[model samples]
Target: MKNVDIDLNLLVALDVLLAEGSVTAAAQRLGLSISAMSRTLARLRAATGDPLLVRAGRGMVPTPRAEELREHVHILTRDAQAVLRPQMNKLDVDALDLTFTIRVSEAFMAFLSAVVVAAVSKTAPGVCLRFAPKPDKDAGPLRDGVIDLEIGVIGTTAPEIRTRFLFNDRLVGLVRTGHWLLAAGDVIRPETYAACYHIAVSKDGNTVGPIDAALHALGLERLIKVVVPGFPDAMRIARQSDLVALVPQSCVGNHQTPDHDAMSGLASFDLPVVIPDFKISAMWHPRRDADPAHKWLRDTVMDICRAAYLQR
Candidate 1:
């Protein structure tokens, strides 16, 4: 049978025609003209490779093949109707047993993971959030369904990818306690900052960034002594040595958290150079936009991140 080309509308028509056993009756039921119904029946027969209906005296009767298909076709048509029906897809959070993978930067993940897990555990106990390091801003994972969400500064991505602003993040300087730059005070002058050796954070290991450009604009530059793949690594290196780490505010843990206490020896100061704050966003593929469970997960994360920012 050449049924590969058959569409949902054709399946629906087949169900009605098989049940009614009359072309005129089926046409009226489907709100189509008698001639249009006849044409549809012809197409269905051609596609099914069967004489689905034939005249018996003055009325029509279903063939053996049609009788066999009638029940299955009706069930399929009804299921299609239910799936395409316009209604709120209500989700039972407690019953959901799906694991969603989120691609995120190590810095943000460090601060966000515990709180996000706590929240999700309280509400949807069965759901799991797997955090994967984002090596770069590649939208391929979301497109291929390898990841359900992405959290980071949104950059060049597919135009169709959906993004929502989570919070604004600004660059901050991290230095070890009693560092020479902070010997005078918490505020370091541009020249003093420029004199210090720096640790640059780049997932792809590119050394120069916004801070470099800002410094060069004033004919001042900081020597980048080391390049790290993540902000956490930069923070660690900064804590143990005199090398300065420049990181986003989001990378700093909440003041109330033990994570923050762990960084008590490292002081965070505003950058002497002017670097504009960038928006950290939640990005996902459009295919999951209207999915109830996915929407719940997005909203949950958005709310948590917003509250976390407020606390910071």
Candidate 2:
């Protein structure tokens, strides 16, 4: 067998042929005459060293080799189209209409929604933001270009994705005011903390976390009576029960209501145990790292997070 070279144009022709499964239909799709498309297919077959398409009754049938390359040809054509499309940076923000899908934690969305919406609207009125739930730190979506941005701790990010630290957050304990734990003392000691029933937020359903690691180091472990999926659920449980909740201090800031009395029911305290502070970051595919619109969006988020943390 001899090595053969293939061109992108032929790849596109092959993709259309595979999809339509007929030379005439492929020609129509590619806006070319049937003879031109047939010639292209012949070239493609020669280049690939395979009889890619063979006549089968009324329509063309893909040979085994062609069938194997069908999906790859389509993927290459789509990627090429994306690359050949007019550069986003060259378009005017006011005239550009595009949607960006962001995967973020509920806590981050609740706190940053207003700021993010305002920032984008001010410069790019035509742009739309689609907020998606980030139940796990999977980088596959980002790598495949399905997710435009990911906001959370940087632990699960892929090595190739570009990441910028948004801010650092420390775990703090929250409890309902007038709770026995608070009434009993001005400062929470490790022993007193370990004795209280706690609500744990484990989206992945894991019992151990940074807080647990810290407690282990101190020779103490809080008894988690309830394990929930999110911080909001833990807060809800903490509001009505004597159970203590360990959460990011920033996560609870946006939930503060207007009623002073209602606000007074919850109190946040620093954990007595030593734990490493986690840095939250915004991550995106490297292909979009240099895009001006994406850059602006990322910078706006970083700025808002910085300001929000400073205000707290």
Candidate 3:
């Protein structure tokens, strides 16, 4: 690449020409006269030092260089359009046609999916939502635009990402109904709870976590019988066996049929140990902070979560 003084407007003309493959068609697409499009193509060729298009039997064909620049040119055009568009007072929710990728924990999805879906459907009918598995709290995906929103505990979020707390979540204990522990207790005591075999849920496969730390405070420890990567998986195991699962309270909803049947053999109780309630928040890149549609989405999601919490 050499230092060349080229007007950015020529890049759009080149993009249109390569896409249409004919000056007349490009001109029609661009709202320009055929002669004007021809002149623009001439300027583009000079700027790139290549006859970017060559004449075929009846139409034009992009040369190798023009083919190479096609995708880049299209991306540049889109970015330029985004920058030049006038800001709107409110998002046109019903007309939104954007795709948003959200990174979230499986626990959040287990509880919040229906609320999120209903809220978004009522507002942005054309918007598509992609949920990416969140293996950790690293902010790389959010910063790089791979993830539009992150829903999880607020602790590890990057300083630059904007976050709004959706709700506070506390740890609770779960077991199969008619379990021995529930039969023996009015209130779960740390000693008996720690004596039970535990089914742990850890994203990274670490069996020990804040739950263990809370137990350690009372000089007790639960023997982890199994370790899984998500809350739903742990609950599944607990529902089938004698193992106890400590999970977020908000996550245990009306059980599915099999689980509902399984529940006749299990029980749920508040954890005897004290762990600080964690804040689950929705985080997004600052670049989209002012986007009307994105702002609407963020607000809608927050409202849904808040309403769900109140109703619960």
Candidate 4:
């Protein structure tokens, strides 16, 4: 058995030597003695079995073999430097082409999809955002790398997952323009609001939530005549029928243009009973905490959410 010696430093020296075409200049460029560089060149010639450089009258010239390896050696060295260097430089969003999978609720996406898409298009035209449904807050997709981001209230997440608060959201009631609730009075009391048939929105088919508990505490309960899988469906039902749909304020949007507003043609009213405002956050795996693209995505989302919050 023969031992094979591998030295990566020789590649760097060879790249400098081929570029400068002089042992003395290569040594000066690499901060090494000329004698040391000469010995390094001898080692490179013996290793590659090629006279990489030869005398050209007053100066040195790269041999055909050296020229062949020049471009390859330069690329390898540059790639190595990029790989080892810290990514502290500014990101080139325009040139970045990437697809990011985000697990988000249909309601939030419906409210902010247009704005988010427009923002990404203006800044990172080549980046694509793939929004997936948030069936449950398991946070498994983030840990498995199946999704780059999970946007919603933090729940049942891994201990190591990173989360950034986006905004605070609370439940709001939605009804049709000529609904009897609006005709009832300026303020719909708990009993009056509860008396109306309600459309319960639950992804997991559970018809009960904090609203129910609050009503129960007051010895009043709303009639949940219909159950839907998501907020969008609830809103649709509330628009056509006389059912009341309770959804997040963010789902209806704080200040959306009429064309982009999800609450268009529908009336949004504050819930009669108090429901605690929950913090909406963007969650990601700890492994992506330092990724430049992931950071940009998070920051962009944060900015959008901040703008929405400010409008409120």
Where's the lowest-lDDT run of ten residues in candidate 4?
Answer: 255-264
Worst 10 residues of 1 by lDDT: 253-262
> What tens digits encode model 4's per-residue C-alpha lDDT throughout 10-119?
98999889878999989976779999999999999988989999998999988889888997998898678548645757888887787788888775797777788899
TM-score of each: 0.69, 0.71, 0.71, 0.70
| Model 4 segments more than 4 A misplaced | 1-88, 255-261
Q: What local lDDT does model 3 show for residue 167?
A: 81
Sorting all predicted structures by TM-score, with the top scorer first, yields: 2, 3, 4, 1
Off by over 4 Å in 3: 1-78, 84-86, 253-266, 310-312
State the lDDT of candidate 1 residue by residue for 1-312, as single tens digits.
333654668998998898789999999766799999999999998888898999999999999999999879877876786587444567888877877899886757877877889999999999988888787788877875658999988974499999999887788899998888888976678988999999987766678888889999989998889998878889889999999999777677644442665476798888998888888899999878887888999999999988888565
Give the runs in model 1 whose Cα sits over 4 Å from its true position.
1-88, 254-258, 310-312
Across 1-312, the per-residue lDDT of candidate 2 in tens digits comes to 656555778877888788778999888756799999989988987788798889988877889998899878778887896787566647477775777889987668756776789988998899999888887788987876658898988766367989988877777788887788877667878888988999988867787887777778878887989999888788778888899998776666633322233235687777877888778889999988777777778888888887777454
What's the residue-level lDDT of 1 in candidate 2?
61
- Candidate 1 TM-score to native: 0.69
lDDT of each: 0.84, 0.79, 0.79, 0.84
